[model samples]
Target chain A: MRAIAFKEWLKLRSWLGFMLAAHLVFAAWLYLSIRHQFRFEHAEMIYYQANHIGRIFYDDLRYIPLLTGALIGAAQFLPELLRGRLRLSLHLPMGLAPLVLAHLGIGLEALLVFLALDLAALAITIGSFFPAAFIGSALLTAAPWILAGIAAYFGVALTLLEPRRRYQAANLALSAGVVWLCHRSGQYQAYDLVLGGVAGLVLLLAPASLQAAHRFRNGEP
Target chain B: MTSRLLSWLCLAFLTVVLAAILLPAIYAMAFAPRVAPTHLFYSAVKQDFVYREHRGNHDFTYATASGEHFDRKAFEMSLPFIYYKNMELWGLLPIEIDGQSFDMQAIRDARQVFELKAREVADRHPSVPVHALLDSDPGKAGLSFPEDVFRMKPDRMEFLDVDENRVDPALTDRFTEALAAERFAFPARLVAGKQTILKPFDEGVFLVDAEGAVFHVKRVGDDPVIVRTPIPTDLGIRSIKVQENRQRIYLGLVLTVDNRLFLLQSDGYGLVELPSSGYDADRMDYKLLLNPVHPTAVFGDGGTVTAVALNEDLLPIAAYSRAVPGTTGMIHARISKLLFPVTLSLGTGNSGYLGWTVSGPAPLAFLGNLLAVGVVLLFGRRRRIAPQQMIPQLALAAIAGLYGVLAIALLPGPGPATGATGG
Candidate 1:
């Protein structure tokens, strides 16, 4: 398990770093834009516009997390599945379920770590110039974006392992449903409790992939 | 087989939620009857409820409750207080009201309006309860966002400067001291401020302290002035919205714990609770139109409009709740109830958010569903399909109604997948 975890980490480390750097640079850009509005222009003006008018400055990073999630998930699973290397992974000193979980678990860890750092950057850059409540709302708004990223991970993984195109389409469509569910609310904190449930439900995607893996192993297409 | 079944179960959960939200939306846009919105308002001068609604494309009809009809000019003249300038231009304005010459400027000056939307009330998230106050003193000619907003602690306050991104220790201490002198309990509950960039002048923020005491905090040029404003302790100030008006009669609006609305008196901290009969947090829409004669408030479920007339004292003189004709498509609602087992909607009332609610087709939805099943069954009987295969179809048709029947009809499920599964 340790060897597999380390091996998976090594494979994902550079991609993880890239995701982090990209997100950090993006967060920096968002900060500079807001800072520009505050310094040269009246900071108070932007503050009121944000609270009253419901215009968000961080709209650029709306799908960045989703993009990164897809990339990381594809990188982790596609290379293994494309060469039928998952068959080899099935023989790795563990059961197929636990082994597959280990692979997904490591990939998800990288995604979560990068997301945490990204959220922290948002807090510092935007938080410095705003009150706690405004910052809290902004973060809550970002929750769906982050969830979309995670959903993308499982979605890409499942699509990679599915044998039939029909089943793969179903996988993608349903996964999109979950992501869309997270993003349904524009009101702040509207989905806070429900999103936690959604996050737990996304784990089911890992177990769900077992069916696809079973088919792929048996050449069931 | 188990793995496939499990996967389908999970997928089913997600698909149902999606269908619930989507199918209804699809049905509403495509099948629902078109409803022309009716704009209704009561005119005091006309002494009749006025309504103007579109009769057809690019056509409208204006009417009054007394069966009087009006053209655009007469319509404007009828609500003289609202369209006073237009009435004056057309010479339709009565020179005298109750035999006394009316002052147009005075009427305009007395007009005031404040609106509350359910979305606005639901959208607030806790910010770091820090506030920046501007000096309302005439010596300070312009209004600007404060350099720093202050947060109170026990025996202390901290001012975070936006530009510097650091706490202004000295200013914090000065304000803290002033607040202490006024006997303001530390750690405010509700701190309301007009955080707008450009304002006529600063009206400062209102603060409710830990002990439920209200205090007015302002930056008077170079000095800080904090005054304890008395408010009823039991009022349970849910929210404080500071509305800075030139009149300066009332400072802000307060939403209380008991769901009552009050005008925060600018003369003092006294609250003049509005005569709200059925105003609740769930109220989808609220509109306050301050005509010269009286203020009118309309609350609605996004379909029905309840209009309230307020007298000179801003007390409710009379209020009538009426559902606007064609605001909701009656035929569509009835038809939809029959087609769907339960339709998913984002929100019909207010606070627009995607939420799952059970909505079945109405009118004859159950009957509509039965008819659909009957058609499918009649076909199945002719095809000589096994009774077992038809059971799931009938079951879905019964449960999900029209949507389910349509799904089964359009895309028949691959009865059961065969082939190597967990082989």
Candidate 2:
């Protein structure tokens, strides 16, 4: 496990660092932009717009986590598949399921760290102007977007590691569908009721890459 | 084995959910329903109910319930008060209707139009609970957005100044004491106000307290005017919509849990219940048209529009309903029912929240499921799969219908092909 972790760290260190830097930059940008709104516009009107008119100040942050997850996914798996390193990794003493899960698990941990930072930045920014109530609703609104990040990470892994072209296309389409479901509504706490279903999809997609790894090992076309 | 099965199940789940969401949308887009807006009114001149239906090709049909047709000019002449401007424009005013004459000025003052949509009743959007109370008596400066917004907490009323973003203790205590004097239950359930500078004046805020008692709160020249209304506490009020009109006859409209309509009459805060028949607030759009003579309440669902006219004493005088053509019987609708066994809804027209509801047209859906099973069997045969290997796919198709078939076809099942047995 340590050897695999070391190898993953060697491959992912630069990407992870770049992602962390980008996330910090995004957090600062979010804080400054919202602060600019408060400084120029009437804070009361802003609150009214957010509460009544369904205006989302943090809408730009919606797709940032998605991109982060996708980039981390490509960084972790594309090289391994291209260099046929995954084939040798499968020959390791570890079980195939654990090996595939370990790869996905590492990428997921990195994505979660970024998502947590994104959420923290959002909470602090909204908290600066609005009350604690606004913070809760803002986080709830971002819940599905956060789920989209997790789904994208698993989806990229599944698509990249799949042996066949058609199955890869299938995985890609399925992943897009799940992401679309996550972003179907832009309202605050819109998906609060159905968030469990989305979380269930993330749980399912986590173990899904194992099947693709098994198919690759069998040399299935 | 469990992991492989879970993976297969995951694929199937994704397939079904996506297909269920997308297929119906594509079907709806292909066979979009068209319904014309029909306006219903009470013809005080004829002492009957009438409707003007806007049909396709710019065709308009004006008629009464007894099949009495009127030309465009005559239709406007029938409801003199409603079309008072048109009547005056065409030199048809001063005509006596039920022994009363209406000038444009009188009609304009008496005219009240209130539209209630299903989405408003659903309250899907999270509105800032803090309300900016416009000074009801803005005297010279007119109605303006106040600096402080007040929130009705469970125990007391809290005021927050927008500029400082801090609670004003003096203002909060003053209003909280006023509400307390009225014996108001501390926790508020519903607070309705028109928070805009667009209206003629402000009616303050109408609140339903913890015990469902109604109270009116407003600011008039730095003094808080609170009135505990005479509305019964057990009224089970579902929603309250406040409209500050020029007439000052009524403050706003109230919808009860049983779908009854009541006017919050300004005279001593009395409740006047209107006669509503076949009105489901959850599924219908409401239009209450108040005139000096006969007041009419029209409720329109997708398929039909029903209107009830009330006499001066607020008694139901006449009722009329018109059927609006819908797409339920259209060819595409029939085809959709035959192709898709179940409908999956994420967001409904009535509510703002996103939820998942799976409703199947059972018995009719069974046919679609059977057809899906047949298609899966053919695909299995083409793949040279053994019968036992096809069991799970066939069963899923039988249950999820077309969605299941799409899922299984899009996602490969776990395990190797059983083609060796066939060979």
Every model's Cα RMSD, please? 4.3, 3.0
- Considering only chain A, what is the TM-score of each predicted structure? 0.91, 0.98
User: lDDT per residue, candidate 2, A100-124, as tens digits?
Assistant: 8888878888889999999999999
DockQ list for all candidates: 0.35, 0.56
Looking at model 2, residue B423 earns an lDDT score of 12
lDDT score at residue B200, model 1, on the 0-100 scale: 63
Q: Which candidate has the highest TM-score of all?
A: 2
lDDT of each: 0.68, 0.82
TM-score of chain B of each: 0.83, 0.88
Q: Provide the global lDDT of candidate 1 against the true structure.
A: 0.68
* Candidate 2 chain B, run of 10 with poorest lDDT: B414-423
Question: For every model in order, what is the number of clashing pairs?
Answer: 14, 0
Model 2 chain A poorest ten-residue lDDT run = A212-221
* Runs with alpha carbons beyond 4 Å of true place in candidate 2: A1-3, B37-40, B45-48, B51-64, B67-96, B122-124, B321-324, B417-423
In model 1 chain B, the worst 10-residue window by lDDT is B414-423
Residue B70 miss distance in model 1 (angstroms) = 5.0
As for candidate 1, its interface RMSD to one decimal place is 4.5
